[model samples]
Target: MGPTRVRDLSVAAVAVAALGYAVVTLMYRHFPPITALSGMSLAVVALAEAGWGFYVRAQIKDGHIGIGGGRLHPLVVARSVVVAKASAWVGAGVLGWWVGVLIYLLPRRSTLRVAAEDTPGAVVAACCALALVVAALWLQHCCKSPEEPPDDAEPAAE
Candidate 1:
């Protein structure tokens, strides 16, 4: 499969963000507060993904940093690409969701104490989601074959 495109991710994020904003707007009274624990969890995921991306990049370029034989197999690189694509999609959705939450809460913060308190957590969550997307995209790029031409390049005639 091809690498994850930014255009696709942007569309998905916009769609998800609109949906999330609508849902939260309609049911904000029942919404729970954004806790520090939840923010920490998102940060943990971001950190892990970033570390994995670095490791994958090293493996793909160097092929001498992994376990055992210190060489990355082709299948492993393919699988990593798949994981990166999936992670990008997931991260975009999550980022959209948190952004929706922030949009709804930011204006109401003056009147709603909970909203004011939760704003920081929502911001943290959104940033972490963005980090995940970056890490995933980097991993996908690392998986690309060095000899392959750029996407804009025309193919040679047979």
Candidate 2:
């Protein structure tokens, strides 16, 4: 497949955010308190992806061989690209959700103690989701093969 489009991601995020905002507006009172750690899992995943991106980039730059002298399989890179694309979409959706929640909560924070309490969690979650998107995109970039030179270029004279 081709590279993930930022335009598509943005549209998805906007749609999800709208939906999330509607849901939150309707059912926020029934939901439990949001904790700061609620989004930590996303952050953890982002970190893992970032590390993997670095490793894969190094391998690709070194001619598709690992630092340990093992060849990097094509399937492995394909799988990584899939994972990166999936994670990027997920992250965008989640980031939208948190943004929606924050939009709703921020306005009411002064009047509602619950909103004030949950604001921090939503902010943290949004940041974590953003990090995930960036890391996933980086991973996808790292997995790309180097560009080939134009076939029409003249050969160097001996």
Model 2 vs. true fold: TM: 0.92
Candidate 2: minimum summed lDDT over ten consecutive residues — where? 62-71
**Model 2 segments more than 4 A misplaced:** 65-69, 150-158
Please give, for residues 26-83, the per-residue lDDT of candidate 1 as tens digits. 9988977787565566567667767776776777667453446757767777887888
Clashing pairs in 2: none
Best-performing candidate as measured by TM-score: 2
Separately for all candidates shown, the number of backbone clashes (residues 3 or more apart, or on different chains) is 0, 0
TM-score of each: 0.84, 0.92
In candidate 1, where is summed lDDT lowest over 10 consecutive residues? 59-68
What's the residue-level lDDT of 96 in candidate 2?
91
